[model samples]
Target: MKSKTVLITGGSSGIGKAIGIYLTTKGYNVYGTTRNIAKYPNFNDFKLVQMDVRNAQSIKDCIDEVLTNEVRLDVVINNAGVGITGPLEETPSEEIVNAFDTNFSGPLNVIKAVLPIMRKQQKGLIINITSIAGYMGLPYRGIYSATKGALEIITESLRMETKSFGINITCLAPGDFATNIASGRYHAPVIKNSPYEKVYGDTLKAIDKDVDNGGNPIQVAKKVHGIIEAKNPKIHYKVGTFFQKFSIILKRVLPDNWYEKLLMNYSSK
Candidate 1:
């Protein structure tokens, strides 16, 4: 059997990289994308192609390049996204737009590019990497949460729409995992006298700490591989510590104000 081809966006580091390396070990043809191919001088895990998820043309070029050599694209993992944290009022509008573009629309772009090809072949798989935070709005990370939440909903719709074409789509919402996401995250400056300064500032530190102490990303990779091999994938999947995953269930069962209070108390901790 010919090896199945897989494409992952923002694959140079973090979860994307972990997924790429693991899939490669499984003998899948993996191509990871980075906006700047020159950045990784020593990357040899799989294959790194040039792509900026924000740009449609770049995504197309990357997909084209992959198909040019391999002739078949089987799986696409939309994993490229940015983290944005700040009080929603303080975050620049442009920055909010950028976050949406990268986190939500970026995945949509990849799906658009791959759908035609996948439909032509009459079979394909797309796994959208979302965040558990997206299940609810957090204190300082509202923008990031909104972005991921949007993608999560869209995934549900896309899955049903594309199922007839033999295209499978599912979203995986991960809780915090140890990666460099905190470093690349855009932080709106904490104005000295702003009303939310102390609270937002404190919450920001806790956010980074949560990511720093999170679980190994390879666990996410393993989940992805299992999804790939499944005969019928579910619409939603999440990988995280017991507490993190439980938080979603808590939100579902708790009353509105009660859940808000719970989140407030958790953020304050």
Candidate 2:
């Protein structure tokens, strides 16, 4: 009879914001965290916490505030991330570290902070927003894909570990949802001075074009709503346009050499 409480990271914009709005409208109490809550004044229905996932102290403070106020967390959505585009050889070490910290460790930190409360309650859901890139490698997205891939593995392990605790873990693997995530792509500062700059310059431009043509974020949010409301959420859910479904099938059915060529051909365009 009680309304469920959902906590989302990076909920100010894009997929996170869409999901927050949808779930809030559905009568779930929602809390969202962002580095700049002032920038997102439209989130009047949900509590906004100023927290940066890369900082341990900030995460602790944010979680503590939520626990103090809400007392119990019914769901935790790990959606905070960044995009890095460039050849691995041309990418700087700092950029790679930042990408991993935000996309991978950010979710781990949030889950760790929320698990105790969920354990106490004896029932909860953890949803990880990963990407189709998690399942397969892609050109110019080496670091980004690595982060999502790591998350997919972690989600699977957590699902198995938490089954007995009445906590559910689901990894939502969406393929190319239209979001500002594309605009957040960071070009390594070292690339400007690196010898392989020319090799990745054109590839980065192509990546931007691909993102611009990606599907809608609202659709992905709808999928998130369905997953959360379902009596039994699947281990992995993929949502996107027809192309995404096709890609998922290809990745599973096609041979490795053929899949590599297919991805390379798609990326080159």
Candidate 3:
């Protein structure tokens, strides 16, 4: 059997890199994309290509390069996203646009670029990396949550639309993971006299700590491998700790006000 070719966006580091390396070891041909290929002069775990997810042309060129070398594009992981944290009121409009462009539209661009190739093959899989935060409107992270939540909802519709074409689409929402996302995320500065200053400051610290103490990203990588091997994958899969996954369930069962209170209480911690 020919090895499956996998393309992962933002595959240079964090969960993306972990997934690429793990799949490579599992006998899959993995091609990871980075905005700047020059940064990873030593990235040999898999094929690294240049791509800016925000740029459709870049995505096309990267996919073209991959198709040039491989016969079939088996899997596409839309894992390229940026982290944005701040009170929606305080975050700059431009920054908010950037966040949405990178986290939301970026994945759409990659999907559009690959769907044609996948449709021609008559069998393909697309896994979207969402977030547990997306299940709710997280304090100081509302925009980030909205972006992922939108993708999650979009995945549902996309799955049905492409099912007839032998294409599979699913979302994998992971909780906080120990990664370098903090260094790259856009953070709205806490103002000296602003109303949300104190609480926002505290929440920022907590968010950072959560990432610092979060679970190993390799766990997510393992989950991705399982999803790939499954015969019929579900529309939604979550990779996170007990509490993180449970939080989503709580929202579904608890009263709206109660769930809001629960989130507030948890964020205060």
For each candidate, C-alpha RMSD in Å?
A: 0.6, 2.1, 0.6
Candidate 3 worst ten-residue window by lDDT = 55-64
The positional error of residue 233 in candidate 3, measured at the CA in angstroms, is 0.5
Candidate 3, residue 128: lDDT: 97
> Clashing residue pairs, candidate 3?
none
lDDT for each residue of candidate 2 in 61-134, tens digit (9 for 90 to 100) = 98888878876889999998999887777678999999999999999988888787788899999999999887
Q: Judge candidate 3 at residue 34 and give its lDDT.
A: 96
Residues 53-122, model 1: lDDT tens digits: 8999998899989998997899999999999999988999999999999999999989999999999999
Model 1: per-residue Cα lDDT at residue 262? 91
Clashing pairs in 2: none
Candidate 3, residues 1-269: lDDT per residue as tens digits? 99999999999999999999999999999999999999989989999999999998898899889989999999999999999999989999999999889888999999888888899999999999999999999999999999999999999999999999999999999999999999999999999999999999999999999999999999999999999999999999999999999999999999999999999999989
What candidate 2 gets wrong by more than 4 Å, as runs, is: 38-45, 189-199
| Candidate with better lDDT, 2 vs 3 | 3
Q: In model 2, what lDDT does residue 156 have?
A: 89
